[model samples]
Target chain A: MAGEREQPAEPLTLRRVAASHAAARVVVSASFEVAAGEIVGLAGPNGCGKSTLLRTVAGLHPCERGEVVLPRSRTPAGVARVALVPQGYAQSFWPWASLRSGIALAASGSGRGWYRSAAARAQSLRAELALDLDLGLRPYQCSGGMLQQAALLRALAAFASGPEVLLADEPFSALDVDVARRARAALRRFVRERGVRALVVLHDVESLVETCDRVLVIDGKPWSTDGASEGVSTARMVLNARLGSRRPDGDADAAAPTTSSFGDAMARVLGAGPHP
Target chain B: MTKGSAGRLALAAATFAAGLALWLALARSGWIGRTLLADPIDVARALAGAFDPAAPPGARVLVHAEATLVRALAGWVIALLVGMGCGVALGARAWAYVLGEPLFELARAVPPILAFPLLLVAFDFGEPAYVGTIVLGCVPIVAITVARGRLGASRERSELLAVFGVPRSVRALTAIMEVMPSCFLAARLALSTSLVIAVVTEMVFTPRSGIALGALAKEAQMSFETDVYFAVVVVVGLFGYAANVVLRAVERRLGLERSTST
Candidate 1:
């Protein structure tokens, strides 16, 4: 009788989403709700459709057979309110535009006069990010960390305009430990301050535990649990089990945890310890 | 200021002085014919004399320069606007590129000078002919640059825009801004090419209505006024340098360098 009870609909909803590449089809079907200010983490093995799911949610990838519905007050006017901060800092930015201009462009739509006061916005963003960059310098001139911070600043500027949801796909993939920690902290603070719901796609359980309120482990499919701090160990175990089962040849167990370097670091940070 | 800026300025000055010294030494030694390469002093004097109000002021130089500038600017503006628009369309769609690739490649391969005879046949040697030549030279360069810039914009960012429910105009503007640096660089190179074409077109085909500076220089050479010829050469060099400086300043103001480096 309890199992038969109808589930409450979410502000954002995805049902029976499926994706495919040239090689194979990855299927995903799940139902989840995210309230305002909630931080959700998605963890899974490599190529397990974690990033794919996030990309689909962000409208980057078209779903094979599913529906992604964003809350619309009226039935006729359908629009999803979401912002995505992609994985790579370098890829996310326009290499030609200055940090200030890029961020301002992200903040303001094609309204002619919105960009008139770009200088003031840029100065505030630079200060907020603790970046002492010459707003004149291009993307190529900055280091990786600097680019990431600049990107984060751009995302914050966009978020300021009240996008309901933020989809971050492996925000710390290439960053070093210290920088990643700082960035993760900043992201957490942003979610809290803005009261914006976030669905962060990551392979590392530790980062999820550190930054997310709930963890959704998509080993074979989507299996979610509340309290990411406590759920990290379970997530790691699920990841290890998935890796063990799918790993190739006699060296499968001996090949170690293959969930990316960032994932490995995250495991350590989440108290799952280093790869055994 | 910084030591680096000072050092660069010194290096530039030294190079200019060395070039001048070499020119003087060659003239003094009579290694090259004095008729062909006039004395620097004589060239300077001729330059001053040409500009003097008392002497029949050769406002010809200014007139020629203005004509060339007008042709170059008109052709460049037309080429850049049209080329970039077409390029964005092609760049955004693979099928468009495939469809237009052969025509673009063919047009780009044919030199503007070669196209001059065709224009002469059509327009019968006038401003249209010269402007047509410049447009022929510049459009391909701008189009290619715009195409490349559009290709270079991240798919991720475009998807982000879609996710945010941004309007079509907003998407286009963002895409253009993302590719603006490449477009600017391409436009600058195209401007230089357009200037060269303007001069060449003027030199080869002297219009009945206008005596272009390039034709005037040629006339001076034919009459063996070596100093006047060199003065024209100096004027051309100054104009080219000034154009380059202006373009660089515009590039800086638009944050083109910043986008390029990143």
Candidate 2:
């Protein structure tokens, strides 16, 4: 249920949100709810509409049949209600706009009168996210992983002051192991401290099991008829795991099971091919 | 200068010298008729005489240059506004592109100068006709280049703005900024075309008043003042080169020197 604008944060609910590309329906009435302060991981097979589903929730993709009833906004008029960290990190920024400009643009809308200017708003977001990087650097000048972090920063900057949700698609795919670990902590702290919800489509079972408060397996069916639904309901929407959120010590890795022992059931949901 | 640039400069100077020598030889041999070609020295003297304050008012090339610049720039501004606006619109909408692309292509296929007669009929013989001619010549090229630039913009950036709910004004500004390189190219091409079309129209129809470079060329050719004709040719060439240099400097200022179509 959506909380009142001035009330405490409530869950972001998707009521039969369906999306199609051309004639083929990629998502078939996929319904789910993500409670505030929770980090939910979405797992599905490769070529499935996992990314598309995230886009649908973020209001990027067109929802054809149903509505994505967004949570009541406590955010001021200028802030984004929902933000998405889309795939393709490197191309997320134009050659002209710097890392700071990208964030500043999104934050500028939300800053209202709270900040001095767009650049100032961007600076505040960097401080809030605990990210340290040169905001002056262009996307082409930065490494792929750095671009991913920058992309994430710009995403969060939109809803930083307002009550909103973040939908990310494999944000860690570009980061190295060491960077990914730190990113997990920062994300955990942001979600917990802000009491906001985030739904991320994870690439691996380890990340799904360790970082998320809960995991939901969306449909694994690929669009066959060029976005027209074969009208099949073969997907068994499963809540496969109820793993707790990141550990307070910031070493959620120790509490998580190894990839081999996490069981094939979870692996299959994460699109890691069936266990032998 | 760097080795590459120095070498390029040397080669260009040598090529120019060789062309001048060949022209002198052709004139001396009387192979080309005197009415059609002037001696290189005579043309240079006439060119220098244009800058000489003591020269006749008719020989003052600055007045002609000013008219050409004004007419060309006026046309260029109109083309810039119309082309960029249309290009951005067509670029954003696929259906618009589908409907507009064919018309743009058809319009582009016809030489812009060919529209001079139509414009003459529509607007009558005046500065308006000449400006309309230049717009017809260059606007399609600008629109097409900018549309391609819009299409080539970083998709992720576009999506980022869309999802982040950046205001439409912010997004439009971003879109326009992304197409700067292409716009620069279109502007450059349009600048030259505008100059050429302005002169050509002036040549075709002598303005009732005001000095015009094209009219000067036509008058010199009619009177068989081949030296004056060649001097005007040289002046036009210099104008084109100077415009290019200024554009390059502006590109450097904006950090866009590495690309013209990126």
Candidate 3:
């Protein structure tokens, strides 16, 4: 039943989106599609340009080659189709604007005259996350965790108005465990209800396994000085695995996986036993 | 006001009174001649005389005070607008900064007061020369401060705004709001500096009408009217303080803090 829903006729496509920073190609031609209501997890080593890939798709970072094709047509008002939850909580919001204002601004970015309604929705999302945040508090007044929740709420606010694609770069990195769980639940519900696609870059393999419908893992140092777009440099999906009920043990740190069982879970997500 | 602030205000008042008492005592002791240091009572009398409508035209302070105020305010407002625009442009564009910074540094290194003689020659030692002096004196500090504020703004937040496709007007508003605290501080600094430059210009240039606080101070000093000179000094200090208070009030009303706490 889940497989039928996962395989949508028209998925949101990225036809070889390639991005280079200065002389070095950071995201060397990544091509993938996230089906409707699908949460795709992008897992890789540090400096693999996971965030850069998301930014390229969002059209924030300049793409050296290729383009992203959204599944749905744009709204009549020409609102934004993609909402990005940036990696760092510190830079997610304007220091002068209160959390409520920040959320409203994000909402207003996608929809005209939606600030008031969006502010109300943000207030509710703060409550949903069980955050003890005064919506009136500015970004500097809030902690890293609270700012993370606010960032998520801002993205959710943008998504609430329409069927916008969500690209989250380590959304749960700054959040505590319980808050991360709640935020994940909120994200899932929003995606399910809105029928929008999401590509989440995550460092925690366990959460990626638990949250994503499908996982795409890239391996090796894909950057080179010679400007070659061959082999692993082009970021071909080395493994495309389906998520299953393959939970790692509680003893294992979610960040650092030591046991082979965790590796096996990753292998299960990757749909392979192991990679050399 | 909070109890702490109220206590602070009281302490400030007491400290001012103590300073006044010390000045009076030194003046009475004759350590400094009466011509050099006017007693508090005489200075108060001179203040009253200057404020009186019936006082002699040359001794009356209001006309000169108004001239000084108008020049200072005009120069300060012009400097603030021009400085903020230049600062934003320099900060937003790296190429502009690379080109403009060395020129700015060269101008900044020279004392602003020294420009008075050159400006007097250019603008003929009148209101234009004085206003030009004030502008030259204050613009660099305001521009540098505002540029620093704009540069220090969060780059990620800017990218976020771009991602949402926020309108250019909204983005500009956000940018201005981000830099407002620094701008307000720069305004205060600009105001005080403009005030000093205006008075110094008046004293040095000495307009034909002799219609400025600095002109009056110079006259009082030349005529040995020590009391009026002291009173003029006190009034200038009060104006500076009042200008700062007004800036603070406006900042509070706009919900901007004085410091860049963020």
DockQ, every prediction: 0.42, 0.40, 0.51
If scored against the real structure, what TM-score would every candidate get?
A: 0.76, 0.78, 0.84
Choose 1 or 2, whichever is better by lDDT.
Answer: 2
B1-262: candidate 3 lDDT, tens digit per residue: 8897689779978988999999999999989998999999999998788778887777777667888899999999999988888788777766777787777767767777798889878977667888888888778878887887777777777788777766687788887887888899889999998998889888887876778999899988999999989988988988898889788878866767723554
Model 3 chain A lowest lDDT segment of ten: A249-258
> For residues A1-276, what per-residue lDDT tens digits would candidate 3 score against the true structure?
222343234677887677765556766666778887778887767776777778888777788777888765456665436777888656767665778888787666555567788887777766765666688988778888888878877877754553468888888888788878877776776676566788999888656855677666655335321234445534333345555435331111122121234334556554443323
Off by over 4 Å in 1: A1-11, A28-37, A71-80, A94-101, A109-141, A160-163, A174-179, A182-196, A216-276, B1-14, B54-63, B167-169
After superposition, candidate 3 runs with Cα above 4 Å error: A1-9, A77-80, A110-112, A159-163, A223-239, A247-276, B1-38, B223-225
lDDT of 1 by residue, A142-221 (tens): 77767766666666665333446778877776667776777777677666555567888876655665677555555442
The residue-level lDDT of candidate 2 at B135 comes to 88
Best by TM-score: 3
Model 3 TM-score on a 0 to 1 scale: 0.84
Residue A205 miss distance in model 3 (angstroms): 4.0
